[model samples]
Target: MTVRAVRRTSLVEQAVTELRRLVEGGEWPVGSRLPGEVELSRLLGVGRSTSREAVRALIAAGQLHSRQGLGTFVASIAPVTDFDRQLRRAELAHIYEVRVALEVEAGRLAALRRTRADISALRDALAAREQARGAAELVDVDLEFHRAVVTAAHNPVLTDLFATFLDAVRDASTEMVADQGPSPEDHKHDAHAALVQAIEDSDPQAAMAATRHNVEHTLAQLRPERP
Candidate 1:
């Protein structure tokens, strides 16, 4: 409803991707009702059935919500990529692997983009993490600290993607915590501190390396394979 145009595409996937771009890119803000089926099809330069399928796909992906009488509205900007859709089905090992990859980039971005206030928040989160006593407590604090790092990256898309993925990660982490009860991430406090230091110093490479070191510490303990 807020956007100007949707790119013409014949295929349903292309139409869906473009629609997702509109939603994720904030062209169509959350909760905005989409144009009627005919208008949407015209905008997308696709047939009515094709556009309908695309809308349905987005609804299934939880990016759109459809009501009985009211038109379809944007539910979320999440499920932006296939990776997000697959995260729920992914193994813990795979999730950790993705975490290392994404968090490294997040660290690098944070190092380059973080402000004084961001650094202060990160330090506060890490302090809370350091004081955590049990597995659940540690999980809560750990997520907070990592979320602060991602937030410092100054990338809205990455921030949204990470938020979407955190749900799956949290469930798996709870299982892992109960099974092995090893907060291997907590064991690498030095690496965590180094990540903060790197960000404070604006050293992107060092920030990435420290993030890798810390996440991989947990990975090694859980999966035993190097990433």
Candidate 2:
């Protein structure tokens, strides 16, 4: 085999690549502060300007964020693209619309493919939801129940995409509990029980219906005047 000539990268580009590696490898986790420009320049054996350029590039890419006096910190290993930022800023109702789409499919697939362990996890989550006494706890437990359902579907890509909306979903759940006062009409434990039973029995149509009812009930409560 003939040896090919290796292409050379600029110092700033190499620094960017190295910094990205450290962040992605968990050497620098989110919210962890990165070294100052002087120290980074020394460590990376580059000029301070090069280090600054690399850091600025990462900040623009959303991998790092700089505070006025607090220094630079890792924002996310997975850079927040424009599309992701838009999703993060979306209204709760719009977020839930996407959630309903994801979960309806997740429920259907879970009913068809869930293992005994998945069923057990779902049961545990629902039991925890029943026992939750406070709004915060109830919201958490409810999300856990839904998360278990998605996980049971055994699709990694779907699971990851669903996870990205979890914070928004949790916020919406908390708002629902706070506004509706956690009554039977608000929490809808009976509907949740029906969903668990449907999943346990491996009934796809029942599972989808139950999931849709849960989503639509919350949407109706949130937007009662919607036609």
Error of 2 at 7 (Å): 73
The window of 10 residues in a row where model 2 has the poorest summed lDDT is: 171-180
Error of 2 at 211 (Å): 0.4
Cα error, residue 172 of model 1, in Å, equals 1.8
Return the clash pairs for model 2, or none: none
Candidate 1 local accuracy as lDDT? 0.80
lDDT of 2 at 23: 93
- Report the lDDT tens digits of candidate 2 across residue range 1-227: 99999999988789989999999999999999999889999999998877876776676566887675578899999777767544443455677788889999999999999999999999999889888765556666788999999999999999998887776676556444533456575466888898889999999999999999988777665542535
Which clashing pairs does model 1 show?
A: none
Lowest lDDT block of 10, candidate 1? 80-89
lDDT (10s digit) by residue, model 1, range 73-192: 998988546565444334567889999888999999999999999999999998888887756567767888999999999999999989888855665565466446655556557888
